[model samples]
Target: MKTKYQITTFLIALTLLFNSLQLKATNTIIEPDSDKDKLIIYILRNILTRSHYVVKDINDDFSEYVYNEFINGLDPNKRYFTQDDLKEFSKYKYKIDDQLLNEDISFYNLVYSRFQSKIKNAKSYYGGLLAQSFNFRKNENIDVDYEKMPFAKNENELIDYWRKQLKLSTLARIQSKTEKQNAALEKDPKTKVKSFKELEKESRLEVLKSMDELYYRIEELENDDWFSTFLNSVVGAFDPHSTYMPANIKERFDQDMSGKLEGIGARLVQKGVFTHVYELVSGGPAWKQGELEPEDIILEVAQGNEEPLDIVGMRLDDAIKFIKGKKGTEVRLTVKKKLDGSTKVISIIRDVVELEETFVKSSIVEKDGKKFGVIDLPKFYISFDDENYRDSAKDMEQEIERLKGEGVTGLIIDLRNNGGGSLKTAIEISGLFIDKGPIVQVKYRDQDPIIKEDVDPKVQWDGSVVLLVNEFSASASEIFAAAMQDYGRAVVMGGNQTYGKGTVQSVLPINQFTKFDEDLGAIKMTIQKFYRINGGTTQIEGVYSDIAMPNKYSYMKFGERDLEGALPWDKVKRANYNQTNSYQNFADVISNSKKRIAENKKFNLINEYAKWLKENQDDTVFSLNYKSFAEEKSNQEKEVEKFDTVFDYTSNLTFTSPTYELPSLKEDPVLADKRVAWHKSLSQDIYISEALNVLSELKMNNTYNAIVKH
Candidate 1:
């Protein structure tokens, strides 16, 4: 995706630096030398085979393709091509192969001669379609009839007739073209009236229509699975990374790369063709309006409140089509909520769940009316677009600067759900909080390690720092979190550990590619491993939080370490950094923070919810009764809804007749067996609460004491 960085600098050097290898050959692929020639020819022929797309030509230009592609080029607006080493690749730009053994070359030439006959046959196909428009019986070899066959006994039986016809058509086209090409090439120049160049170009053009027909027919056939696998095999010869991700694989790819889409923001899955909601993102639209819960089965969808279309057996993508609409325009989801572990319908309106909804929030925790800065650094995000701006990094920089301006003596940088982004931004942001030093070290393939450093030595708001992380903070987030912990810039706190993702990736966009049918998307392959400045590796084994807290997200089978092909962790020499003076004995300060939470009824509520989650992780079954089920589901929703509600810990707000306050959270949240999870995050959340406490402490430590000041 980044055009500035090019792969194969070797190719670039060859054109300018290497002066001896350049040589030309008569008719086949030539190269600077023999070994490279073999590799080049093998690569070129196959690349052209895959990239040559066919649509009815707009101009019927009759231009030479090799020139059009390599010299003359495809349309200039189609910027699929990057500047290649023209001098280095000049010898290899050719269409025909002449270096094969006499027998193979002769056969190849013969097959090319009859390729035109197939093209002529293709013209008849268009004529057939046009003739049908005028009600003419054109090609009477087979009568085209449309009567549904008797219901087949099975799936295999239904495909039998269609499969045989496709097979016949495929074989006839390939055979005819092969016979003609080989036949034409065998004749002497005297026998062939056209010059060698003209004859060769004509030969290639002749095969174009046939190649187009064969490729299309194979793709359009009934046996998509078999044909797709075959196409993969053909493409596989190029490289391991070249792949065709089918629809199913593409779905997972989209989810992994970008979890947000223009939808209800509820996680769902298809269970026996019925789409069911598994979880609702906290603060999302469905969670905003009360009554939606886990185990809600979607029965229908209405686009902008249109007719509620039943999606009982629709595929996941099809269901998404019915759910997603233009932002701000509403979509009505008729959900079958599980009541008492049984299903019932509940409707909800969909709207965009802005990142602003998930951003670090603040509240003035008044114990004797003292205020402290609570800054949640969800993730170190980079602006995704080079055009428009404002991402986590830029906005976070402004937030920290604002807190500094706000006279907050201490800050909390929360790093939960922050999967990381722009590596460049991470280092720049890390530089903001600390003096200049190495933020992260990267080791590339066969290259020495590169230390990405922050040059700015001036610190911003250096009163006291506390960073918050959970099992989900990863990748670039780990880099900043680990460095801050190692440098003692912040007292890092979280559950047992952060998510381990110590690998660095560089995305490679392929050469000689086009934005045609089935785009060859960029591949983000792992090219390096990352190491922290204090001789630690954050792969699989993530950086541990200095102050541990209780976590509800069970780490048993999740995170980057659990994934296949994850790179192993390793360490490098430590980078020099100046540790800051202790603003306070934060260990005792954190103890007091935990004490405040444990004593508060709110923290205790979190613990109750954790135990509930543990007991019911595999609790995924529900029933279909209407009345009793609905009531049962409502009660369970109350429990889940109370899992993190701050009001659950206190009798601060009594239940009003209308069920007052934010619908997303209720006061005096469920007091039963599910209220202990308040401490779920707070118990292990030493860095977060400590941040609150330390900010108050730092205000006292600074000359600007008695009030919040950095």
Candidate 2:
């Protein structure tokens, strides 16, 4: 009787009814104050599950993923949560998906409350540990890779772990101070060097101060920060790239995208208990005021006619908020100059500051009787609000034209450290090199792939080209490199692979779909995956360099594939496009370059340095004994001295801008100085020199082929 179709249908209905009841029972009611966040959660779920490229169900499997990822992200070092805490949390590991579907945040509340308690306890542990003077003679070592260790069994174990970490940090600081004081005394006989005991006391005081500041900052975390982390964990469960941006974080992103800021215009970093000036914007309020300088430690910040607040022990972001005021508002800063420990109060009015250094710049490098152009594009930046904004493609085209007028024989597009932007711009930039064809193919869920092409037949430069990239070059940068490599338009050179980001993200503002009075931030979701015209996706495998050079980061494992929960690599049908036969003997050319690099002294040095770096990084266990730590550091320094000659190599090349840029360079001293520095570095770069040689080889090879044809 149960085998009948009617019996099967009844069983299915019973299971569904049970799940429905469970969903209702698990539903949580958010507080009235958090109604807006609850609404945002609802909207985000719909967007991610419905509009995202990959649709997934909020079930037990998904709940387990969110729970594990959230906990791991919070306690990356396993220093906070104990074994008992994790055991308790494991109960809701598979139940979180139900809670999320029902808009219940009881799990988040419970975890976050426990997290706060742990942090408070951690603060006490650090305080007690630092209150005791560390023994430098102790023969002990600490594990830097704390992730490999298990969670503490109890409070006693956690306290012991904290003590070891604190001891390690204290030893490092003491070693650094000892070396600095010894060098100072050696340089000047009149300068008095403190005794070892005195130096130890100073190091302890500095470490304690830093720990206090760090804990103070942690204690200041509001509900918004914790909520953002929780929401991000949910979004991140989908993919590494997709995430929710809270209102405050989104505001900073908007400013960075616009390349404009209203502030004192000085970059600051927390050094011990003080916020030290890293750099001053060339044309910003701080530089114009002419009082603030790099390495100056800011002590206090004051608003107009208001009492100054001590910023020495304050968090960097909080200190910055105090220093940054609206346009035309006067903010005062109490600073201490590093060169001479003299305190000075500088007052300045904030104004709109636009960063000019983040733009297209080109320098003409004359090498081996041939002139070549190098265009360094820091980022593929464009303004969505401003239609007439000068984007990477438009500016790059102009830089090429200028370089062409300078009679350069070849071009190099240096996209090193360029974290990509603007997919449209990447396609347009790729088109500038080729005559006209499909640039990249974008595939959305359950839809035919969309082919983006350049209908314009005009080729920007029809000559030997080389594109330079590094591990950090990603997204749009990979797109351009892949297109060029596919079409043989440029010789891709640099690290082994480009950053393998081959996904497209679209920002969805939460308030757009609803009439919410409160500001609900945006969520950037991956909507499509992109592929090269040749059909291969650059997801995890990234575009491989045609000529791989030995790099300092050769040992570092930073790639898309290295990221957790990253999408896998796949291929689609290749777009119909013509492969340019520009370089007929490309393989022979690469082989020859490899041979040359093998014999080059600088390349060998680089290879050795990379190996040494890997060994050093893999060594996670560091000695806490002052003598052993000092000896290890000293050996590292000596090894570094061997590679000093790596930068000593120089090319007999002259660098200059085109005639059109000279007039502007003359007027802007800052711009001229930057150009000079760029040229100086280029001259010292062995990689660029080799790239120039490759261009020369290509030109010679072309000439030989032409003679044979004749």
Candidate 3:
């Protein structure tokens, strides 16, 4: 199933499956004698260029590894693709030669053209959606249930629906031109004489510039991964931590591993091809400037301190390259600020952000005379620094030591929002609690099995452990949780199920050595799949907890099986793990927790709030004239304001002085009221309160045998 998770791919259209590559500049050509030989030579050149990375030489090891990984996700019973096709792919295995790909523009154009036709079919819908989603991704008006869309079931309807999607998106762009002209008029007072029609025309032209956005998306992955990343990126951006990375994104995974990242400690996105800063990282260079912020339009990049170069139509990769640099370098950015509506140049210095700060601060949860240490592992931490290698093993070790000193009785490792990373580190970290043994097994297609075992014979904290995960916990997170659950060492608790990704990915660099060909570089194909020690697979069917909790996310449907081309569930030979005799009874502990939570007034109120939140998760469209829309929006806004005051206390603290007539967090105007309010809500974190109750239950149960188990 792990193999299946990484390998599920669906070709959108029959034409796309076998379409000929397109071209942009076809001014020159050679004598056409050996077209076939030329193509073969081109393939070889492309392969060798990228074939220089780890596990190069295209040896049997690389070939076999690629074969197993890719095949594990394949459907063998169906002969949709023949062995001959497999052989053809083998010849170009682990390679995409530069020479072969020098100017393969035709391929891109073909894909783009086919995709763009859909946009033309429905103009207004595409334009409208684009206008709304672009300006405010938070704008729920553009939301659509893909399963409910007409195109989801019938191919003919699907094409037309997408055409409308494009139209609405494009229309949205047209609305922005008015903003530009209004600005021009404000500045010069001479560029006037513009009516609403004229303004609309200007916006349409500017918006037309982004028509290629969706086209580029379809051409890039051909729907194979377009939908896969849709959920993770689209929704994940709502909260800084949530996101989805399908098994198909090896290149992105490799980028994260490379220690070089983009976005200037911020997030960039395209709601409708108009790229903008989604959010600024706290304490980031951009954040320090107090200039760049969420929803700021990135108009241009100026290298060094030079004149800004326009980048409106640039590729996302190119935009990213322009932003990232050595840790100490500086980059000046020209941004069209959304708030106060101004344009400004902000220069920022690059810096590394510690991932730990993004996570919850560690604290000891005491209940009924027992102590339980709780730590939220947001994502896998395996930084590529030389001395400060941020492996989960080392970090958890330090945390364990600290928690031990705090004199905690049990441990609750929260894996929520931890999408996954560094499988190697996950195994090593899991090994910390359990003695040396097989933690997880990975089986591939027609190949010998490879089992990843924690070599450490030493155990760190063998006390009662509880792992909290949600639908977002995936890959390495799943690996650790599954091993602990399979061994009956820890109780897995969270929402419906964890993200069912159980495959391991190895990033292969396509053009690592070339200084000239900057445009090249595709990350590796998936290399292998990971399985748990038990018989069941963690592929599409993620790990279900011993006890499920109510989550605010309800519109969120269950199971990856709902996804088209999603890899089906399968099983391989299971490995063995011995359950520790010292393991505490989790059922009893859970029962106590349930009783406590049911009686807790705060938790009950939170449950009611969570139920209210579920009904509002889906984005819905609204008209400017709808009274109900205004009322609903107004009511929600009021509720948020009230909750905002409540949220302030739980997550923040206020410091008021003798001169203060009102409470405030800081003297600064921007940080005064809201910050003060946020501090107030810090005490009202209902979910955290529930977790505290569980910790208390574990404490009373394990106090006698509280010391770390060895």
Better by TM-score, candidate 2 or 1 = 2
RMSD of 2: 9.8
TM-score of 2: 0.82
Per-residue lDDT of candidate 3, residues 67-94 (tens digit): 3333322211111223443454455343
- Candidate 3 backbone clash number: 55
lDDT of each: 0.48, 0.76, 0.51
Count clashes in each candidate, considering only residues at least 3 apart in sequence or on different chains: 41, 0, 55
Every model's TM-score: 0.52, 0.82, 0.56
Tens-digit lDDT track of model 1 for 368-390: 34434555554454444463566
Taking all chains together, the TM-score of candidate 1 against the true structure is 0.52
Root-mean-square deviation of candidate 3: 13.2
Which candidate comes out best when scored by lDDT? 2
Task: Show where candidate 3 strays beyond 4 Å.
Answer: 1-314, 318-352, 355-361, 365-371, 383-390, 510-520, 558-562, 581-585, 596-684, 699-710
Best by TM-score: 2
